[model samples]
Target: MNAALPFRDLSPDAPRVRVTLDGAPLDLPDGANLAAALLAAGVGSFRATPVSGAPRGPFCMMGACFDCLIEVDGVTRQACMMQVGAGLTLSRPMGKVAE
Candidate 1:
């Protein structure tokens, strides 16, 4: 676990797998909550608001809040509701520009 991050992995010895975040490679604990893993790995912001472009990350952490929205395998998904898996390609969803 990285001490610099705000969150810590409870299972420090858990198995790790490779995943890509915004094209950057990251080795995260397999089967862990995607949001929690990203947070533990020092990911500060998950996405930007479509309207304001303000940064946002996990909030409710229970699939209620859409703050953790991210693009995974070409689909927009809530990071908090998904698990860390090998070969996952994650990226911040593109926000619509104000007209």
Candidate 2:
């Protein structure tokens, strides 16, 4: 675990799989929650608010909050609802507007 990150992985021994975040390669625990893994890996911000451009990260950790929204393989999704999978390409969603 990175000492600088505020989050820690509960399953330190879990097998790691490679994935990309904003085109940067990262080796994260396989099948772990995407938001948690990213946080543990020192990713503090998941996206920016469409209008204000304020930083946003996982808040509720459940599907109810849209704060964890990210682009997975070109599709926008909630990071908290996803699992860490090998070769997944993730990025902040672009041009999104709040309803």
Candidate 3:
């Protein structure tokens, strides 16, 4: 594990919640960082740069960077600053997605 990664130890029986991404259901532990959870779930990209159309994910786990932008509950938000919640719906920003 990388020392700089925002890794948190979870108990074997950590409670989980169900959230939807791009209409697909995902199970994530409660209170888990949304961006980290998505990445751990194999989501490689979050959004693309508006100009160059480059795919981007989380650059900083904190709220300092806007790379991890996504739609949550009908609004664009920074995934890294949000916690996984039950019934939350998230979608990638509409635009060019990395191939």
Candidate 4:
């Protein structure tokens, strides 16, 4: 994660970013990373490892790793790499990775 690039923290007056998670609408901060947005929505697991089937979430927010995979707009993608956009539908994968 690039801790140097400051991100605006959630506040009462902050404008809402409309997005969908698991078919439900979620209001998050504008320009938030997908991991942070999903975490705010109480989503625990974003993906599983291909070899171990281990659950993953936001690990290295800088996109160096694929630990934050999630389905967005019907395409599986790296959550950490995506900026929170309006009308995004996020979901977890159902298939398990090979061990």
Candidate 5:
């Protein structure tokens, strides 16, 4: 679970961009990191471990960590490394994750 933070409270006029995640629509800051957007939206687990089924969420907001890996337009990408784009589709990467 994500520890809730004051998102809009941080900036009353922060610009927002719309995006779809796991088939759900969300609005987030246009320049905010995608991972942060997910977290702010209370999406805790980005994916589950293929082996132990442990929940994996973003650890580092930088590109150094793969824990935030997500499916972007059918490609695996680190959510923390990208900004929210309007109308972008994101989902949990499924099937045959390397062991």
Candidate 6:
């Protein structure tokens, strides 16, 4: 193994953990919000339209807009308002309906 590879030491400053999103494993930063983390992970959409089945993501990161809504730990929540935690399980909503 190449010793120079990054993330070799998952220390506090270099926090490393895995999270599951829509049944996919994702590695995210230690203290970032789900919205931010998803964005950084190259996720352009976080939700689907109720009527048309289109895609959506964070719009007003301050919790005013309902665009960034998602399900965390089996509960509906705003992705922008929830911080990313280790072993978190997230599922994007297909629409406005609660699951």
lDDT of each: 0.88, 0.88, 0.81, 0.73, 0.78, 0.75
- Model 4 per-residue lDDT tens digits across residues 1-99: 233433435654657778777777778767777787666556667876666677777778888888888899999898888888777887777456654
**Candidate 3: 10-residue stretch with minimal lDDT:** 1-10
Task: Kindly give the number of clashing pairs for every candidate.
Answer: 0, 0, 0, 0, 0, 0
Per-model TM against the reference: 0.89, 0.87, 0.79, 0.72, 0.79, 0.77
Per-residue alpha-carbon lDDT of candidate 2 for residues 1-99, written as tens digits (9 for 90 to 100)? 235867888898999999888888989999999999999988888888888778888999999988999889999999999999999998875455866
lDDT of 3 by residue, 25-96 (tens): 878879888988777666768877766777888988899988899999989999999998999999887565
Superior by TM-score: candidate 5 or candidate 6: 5
* Colliding residue pairs in candidate 1: none
Cα lDDT tens digits, model 1, 27-92, are 999999999999988887888887887888899999998889999999999999999999999998
| lDDT assessment of candidate 3 | 0.81
Clashes of 6: 0
Q: Please list all clashing residue pairs in model 3, or write none if there are none.
A: none
TM-score of candidate 4 on Cα atoms, chains taken together: 0.72
Deviation of model 6 at 31, angstroms: 1.3
For model 6, the superposed segments whose C-alpha errors exceed 4 Å read: 1-13, 95-99
CA deviation > 4 Å runs, candidate 1:
1-5, 94-98
lDDT of 4 at 27: 83
Which candidate number maximizes TM-score?
A: 1
